[model samples]
Target: MNCRPRIRASLLASCLVLTVSSACGGGEAPHSAAVGGSPAAVVVAISDADRAAAKQTFETVCFTCHGVSGKGDGPGSAGLDPKPRDLSDKTWQASIGDEHLRNVITMGGAAVGKSPAMPPQPQLKGNPKQLEALIQHVRGLAR
Candidate 1:
């Protein structure tokens, strides 16, 4: 089935979120854009609330495949051909960039040429605070 319309809708929704966020007058630093119109990294501050939510999300969803200890050996991972990644693997963590992790989290593993079983989190795509919080949590998992 064709997916262009859905892709367009998602893009439009993302643009709308950026526009609304920019107009809110909060102290948030500019995201994905910088002075003189240059492309830049998003700089959202992850709050305590964000961390709580991230933890909940990780426990409820991520831990199903990635174990509670981030060891990639959750009960659900039994007999899987390509097993879940060990989140605490320092070598693997060091090999990937944050943007790659972000894409895999929000767009699914298949988007990054990994297993299709890893689902996409479209809900988190527009929530940088939570996204950053989750990313930080993953980073902290490194052993």
Candidate 2:
């Protein structure tokens, strides 16, 4: 089936969120954005460029196990113990700090007392901004 309508609808929704954000006297998401149905859900108010980069990184690296929307049900996750993290989990996402997220992504799960199955993303390390973007992208998945 064609998905253009759904895609357009999602795009429109996102645009509306931006417009609402601007009208509220700032370009930031309110608290509701953290859980869903808003812009300020994960990470923080980020630039478009950063959002794009983070998304690309997630799609390229994290999607294999985290799945497209981070539900932890990617094709590869089926055979793994503990499975990949469901990045879309709002509570799980909120409880974790940005630093913790960076550590897990940069050094891998084993370094942070998590499952060893999660690989280290050395390429994402050392770059603070890029790391933050990925964290934000993960946060956005909660929505």
Best by TM-score: 1
Per-residue lDDT value at 134 in model 1: 91
> Model 1, range 1-143, lDDT digits (tens) per residue?
11112334244434445454552135443333332332224445456899999988888899999987799998888877699999999999998877777789998998889999888998988787788789888888899
lDDT of each: 0.73, 0.68
Per-residue C-alpha lDDT of model 2 across residues 59-109, encoded as one tens digit per residue: 877888999899998878888998898899989987986667767898899
Estimate the TM-score for candidate 1: 0.72
At residue 93, give the lDDT of candidate 2.
81
Which lDDT value does model 2 have at 53? 86
Worst 10 residues of 2 by lDDT: 1-10
